[model samples]
Target: MATARKYNVEAVFKGAPKKSDFKIVEETLPAIKDGEFLAEAIWLSVDPYMRLFVNSSNVGNTMFGEQVAKVIESKNENFKVGDYVAGMFGWRTKTISNGDQVRKLDRSVYTDDKLSTGLGILGMPGATAYIAFLSICAPKEGETLVVTGAAGVVGSAVGQIAKIKGCRVVGFAGSDEKVQYLKSLGFDEAINYKTMTSLKETLEKTCPKGIDMFFDNVGGEFYDTIIPQMNTSGRVAVVGCISQYNLENPEKGPRLNPSILAKELTIKGFVIYNHLPRWPEAFKAIGEWIEKGQLKYNETVTEGFDNMFDAFSGLFTGKNTGKAVVKA
Candidate 1:
């Protein structure tokens, strides 16, 4: 029998997750059964959603995540040996899968054989940005757009895509490096939300025309600033409320109930899985943008699987400038 190493949750997260919440366990694998394939994880994604999911996830199950893996052996003809796959395979060294919730690697997006991107720009994050922004916000040329959490993979992609649409883009990040990184991605202005003495004053200066579209990734105090400043009929796409993810009790922030009606703003919240049928269209457009030099992406990769907890924890602290992943 073959054995695989896996990281399983030992405790349900109460507040912020700590290293003690997880455990590494070794397990034996049976021979490949019909319609199944064996894959070895090459890269694993450490994302903010897992933080929220952990609170309700099975305590003794493998940690929640996605990975890009190589199909080492296969009994399913659809999944050939040596083919690369992207799936929700969790934090494990190896996977035995029935081909459910898996996608074959798209060479156009993974150009030059960079499979790590399957978990970052070219995968879930990329699809989220492409479909959600274009569908919900419907960005127009010359509009002023504001993006919160602008340094993460989805937010960064949103900013760049807005730039491609000829929108004047402003971004907010937690650190000076991330602000500068957003600027490098052609954001018209990048503000450090943590260091800014007055977010209202900064917005007044940078967004003289008012925000025409808002791509919100972090909701909390930031939402208070953004909602009131939006132009009439502005569109707001709610992706993730990362700022409130780790809280044991979600904090109450400035009220936006009146502001939405006053500004006539259009706001909608979405999950990527809700738009799964559109992934092919999203991948085609994002890949074309990448090939045409219209899109750029970055990743803060941790070196080993043993350090996955560190990488996962970094998302809350703004330790990663873009997508945070573990090289397994």
Candidate 2:
């Protein structure tokens, strides 16, 4: 029998997740039956959404995450040995998958680059930014675009894509380093939300012409602040809200219905899972952008499977500038 090491949730998260909330356990695996493949995890993803996804009901379960893995052994004809797969296989060293909800990564998209990017720019985060901004915001050339969480995986991608569309992009990140990173990605302006006394004032200064599109990744006060500054008929894509993810009780949002009405803003909330059928399109476009040097990205990597929780918690603390992944 083969054994697998997996991180299991030991306690439900209270306010912020703690080290004591998770424990590693070993499990013995039986040989793969027909139509099954055994995969070894190479990289694991840590994103802000994970904090809200895990709840009391999932205690003692494997910690949830996506992984890019190598198929070492297979009984399924569709999944051959040596193929790379991306799946929601949680924080486990190995997975026995029957293919459901698993995607075989196209080597053409990744080339010799880090396979971990399947969990980053070329994966969910990529699709999130591509479809959400293009379809929802419908950015036009010469428009003004603002993105919250601008140094994060989706936000960084959003700003760069807007630049490609010839939009003037302003980004808000938590730290000075992240602000600089956004500037390097060609953002017109990058604001450090933590150090700024008034987010509204800084945004007013950067977006003097008013924001035509808002790609919101962090809600709460920042999201609220940007609403009143939206140009008439502006568009907003409501992505993940990392700012409120760790809270035991979500704070009450400011009343902004008046701003939406006055501006006639179009706001839509979306999760990338709803757009999974279009992932191939996103991959093609993002891959081309990468090849042509139109898109740039960064990753904050923690080098061990044992450090998975630490990497996950970094999403909330703004410790990561872009994608946060564990090199398993």
TM-score of each: 0.97, 0.98
In model 1, pairs of residues that clash are none
C-alpha local distance difference test of each model: 0.90, 0.91
Give the C-alpha miss distance for residue 213 in model 2, angstroms.
0.7
What tens-digit string does per-residue lDDT give for candidate 1 at 19-98? 99999999999999999999999899999999877754568999878999989999999999988899998999999999
RMSD of each: 1.2, 1.0
**What global local distance difference test value does model 1 have?**
0.90
Best model number under lDDT: 2
Number of residue pairs clashing in candidate 1, backbone atoms closer than 3 angstroms, sequence gap of 3 or more or interchain: 0
Candidate 1: worst-modelled 10 consecutive residues by lDDT: 106-115
State the lDDT of candidate 2 residue by residue for 282-314, as single tens digits: 988998898899998899999999999899888
For model 2 the local lDDT of residue 309 reads 85
Give the residue spans of candidate 1 off by over 4 A.
108-113
